[model samples]
Target: MNTATHPSESHEKLWDLIKDIKFGMLTHRHATGMMHSCPLTTQNKKLDEDSQLYFFISRKSELASALAADANVNVSYADPGKDSYVSVSGVAAIREDQAKKQALWSAPAKAWFAGGVDDPDLALLAISIDHAEYWDVKESKMVQLAKMAAAAFTGKQPRMGEHKELNLS
Candidate 1:
């Protein structure tokens, strides 16, 4: 299903699709113009009402430089267990928010930044979401396979899930 969500609903819907998915593949353009993707963990424990998402990454990494060169980026989130997938396109930038770093700081992150929130190499990546697409099929794998086989023999497209596209900005 490809449907347009009402402007009011889109914002909330986008958040619902991604709130629990802890990891996302953030893709950005490199200096060579080639797209590069790296897995990053969303530092926020809860998705704020705004579509923007937060991440913690190494300031010295190429990703940090990529964001500096080009803010346009995409973040993909997936949960195969629930058959829910989301792709978010947004502008990304590295921020030096000390309070945010302290609030989002975690023990696992300490392994990478021994200096903790004060680590010189630590950076906060913020994605100002502009658009998002999601596919949500709340069904079991076996059921989905059966549906696919049935649809194939019956010459019908299997209704996979509730898919929606949102223009967030």
Candidate 2:
């Protein structure tokens, strides 16, 4: 396990693990208490100091309606090739800031919002991160498999990577 001497260090580690990830599986509770998940592209080019994540969603989407009813959410990122995974839990809300939308706006997002940044149906979803946990494995797949085999022979659990949890709130 990797230990962070400071909260900022932990924050940086969390961002490093997820920044290159293309899509995050966002999960939220539905009105019927069922959990729903949808893949959303992370819009942040940089990790904010406050650890907020941004995504663009249609104002009419189920996610948008779910957040309006219940704000708690979790976003999960995985890069199996790199053996890295991150899970972030937070409160979600719709942001009405046009400047923020413009700042995070990109060409690819235009695919979803045909009217570009001025799309009325486009809503900026902000997740105010409260807690995050990550697992990052430094070893290659072959080496990790060997370690797992060794542990299996010894009847012990394999220590494959660094796992840490951070409370950003």
Candidate 3:
């Protein structure tokens, strides 16, 4: 629980892990007060200076409505191959910025938003990250397993992965 406080290098480490993990699962509270989650594609290949993350979503979608009703949300990303995971808590607000949409738009998005940036339903979901936590282990699975076995044989605890918690606000 040493990482329960603010982390010094968490921001940079989080960016490195998430930059290549293009997809994240966004969770929000529904009108009925139930928690819902869905996978979303990130607008940024990396995070902004202020630690904000963006996603393109449909204005008419359930997530958009959820965001309008309650801004608090959580986004999670996982890079299993790299033994990295990130959880970001933030407040989401919808933005109708065609310029930003244009900048972030790609051929992959065309599959959903047929009219591209000009689509009426197209909107940007801006997440102003307030806090984040990450688990980043550089060791491979086999190495971890070997260490665990050695620790068991020696009657010691296995060393776990690195975990950092940050206050982004």
Candidate 4:
């Protein structure tokens, strides 16, 4: 079972867990009923009050076309060194808002979109997060290994650290 947190608190916690993780694996369902994923750099400096995540994608890419057909998506972030993993499910859409593009634009993004925020191929992808879950292990590696070994012998599941689910809907 997962612990529950207040909506705003959960949002903050979720952001805290993923903010430093450089890449999120975004999985989108293709029209042909296959799920495809790609690593996309998260663009938000901070999580929006509306619980949205943004990324810059190529308009000509298959991902763009797949999202147009089905907007539901999942984005997962992991920081193995910290033993933290987060999975966020949401609805995705490509935005054409110029002001937003300018706001999220960064110097590093210029490497891909040389024309900057005005690049024609640049598509702003926004994911309106509805639900998210995270696993954060605070125990030492040795302790975790011992628990795993015990569980293996006893045929019981090992207890990790906190696991929580957040609903933003």
For lDDT, the strongest prediction is 4
Model 3 misplaced stretches (Cα beyond 4 Å)? 1-10, 150-157
- The deviation in Å at residue 129 for candidate 3 is 0.5
Q: In model 4, which residue pairs have backbone atoms overlapping below 3 Å?
A: none
Instruction: Compute each candidate's TM-score over C-alphas.
Output: 0.89, 0.95, 0.88, 0.94
Candidate 3, lDDT over the whole model: 0.85
TM-score-better candidate, 2 vs 3: 2
Q: Which stretches of candidate 1 lie over 4 Å from their true place?
A: 2-8
The residue-level lDDT of candidate 1 at 135 comes to: 92
lDDT of 1 by residue, 1-169 (tens): 5666566688677777778887899999998999989899888776566667899999899888878899999999998888899998999988888998899999999988999899999999889888888999977788899999999999998987788888777
User: How would the candidate models be sorted by TM-score, starting from the highest?
Assistant: 2, 4, 1, 3
Error of 3 at 23 (Å): 1.2
Please give the RMSD to the true structure for each candidate, in Å: 1.9, 1.4, 2.4, 1.3
Q: Model 4, 1-169: lDDT tens per residue?
A: 6766577798889999999999999998977898888999999998888899999999999999899899999999999999999999999999889999999999999999999999999999999999999999999999999999999999999998999899887
**Candidate achieving higher lDDT, 3 or 4:** 4
Which 10 successive residues of model 2 have the least lDDT summed? 1-10
Clashing residue pairs found in predicted model 3: none
* Deviation from native of the Cα of residue 11 in model 4, angstroms: 1.2
Lowest lDDT sum, 10 consecutive residues, model 4, at 1-10
